[model samples]
Target: MASKLSTTPGEILREGQLEKRSDSLLQLWKKKRGVLTDDRLRLFSRSSERAKELRFHSILKVDCVEHTRKHVYFTIVTIDYKEIDFRCTEESCWNAFITLALIEYQNRRALEGFRRHRLLPIAYEEQEESEEPRSPSP
Candidate 1:
């Protein structure tokens, strides 16, 4: 679990180690094995058995805070306004990967919503036309 990131259940978009700032008072950085999938981002820690899942539906956006020669710092903002900080090596570009994946997920959801709403009205219209009594075909 520490060395290999889990890729089961969902398609693996990206997998790597990232440092997450802890929510404790000290705010220490802890190394976590991260697995990005189509649905969510899973973070696993050596000390914990359960993986922390950041589902895309709950994530509002990924904000790139700063980039230095050695590291790139970013924040993941949840829909509820909670922010989680993470950083990776500058060469890794984890920020970009996460952002791209999130945007793609959002677009897919929007398209699904549009299709559902668009199809329902068309189906209703077809049903209404068929139910209407047709007079003599002149």
Candidate 2:
């Protein structure tokens, strides 16, 4: 709850969790010499709920990668083409994004496209006439 002498919120957040309040954990990670542990991760996962907010969605792209083992997948997120990514090992991309956003922001709305089709909100290429949506027969 108290600010550290040498840390800002964002800086602390980087190490804590993929959630918004992760800077503190990040700061501790930088200050401490020990290996990053799962206990800390569990703590951060419980302490913050930043990953649930909608505002962070446009900036964060969440997806899943098939692992070396079949039927096993992990969440791999890239933000704004940045090299740094979020690790969502506990669940699928949808669950990861939901969990992260909840930890980060209270109000959240995931676009239908992301869940239904993994589509980009903005249109780039026009679909062929046959591909267009058709109305049900009267």
Query: Would you estimate the TM-scores of all the predictions?
Result: 0.89, 0.23
Which candidate gets the maximum lDDT versus the true structure? 1
Candidate with top TM-score is 1
Which ten-residue region of model 1 has the weakest summed lDDT? 1-10
The runs of at least 3 residues in candidate 1 whose Cα sits more than 4 Å from the true structure, single-residue gaps closed, are: 1-9, 136-138
Tens digits of lDDT, candidate 2, 6-112: 33323322232232212444623211111111111222234344323223433344344444332323332335653222333342233343335333432323344
Candidate 2 residue 92 Cα shift, in angstroms, is 9.0
lDDT per residue for candidate 1 within 1-138, as digits (tens), equals 122233354888889899999999999999999999877999999898689999999999999999999999999999999999999999888898888878877887898999999999999999999999999877
Quantify all predictions' global Cα lDDT against the true fold. 0.90, 0.33
> How accurate locally is residue 29 in candidate 1, as Cα lDDT from 0 to 100?
95
Candidate 2 residue spans exceeding 4 A from truth: 1-58, 68-79, 86-138
C-alpha positional error of residue 10 in candidate 2 after TM-score superposition, expressed in Å: 14
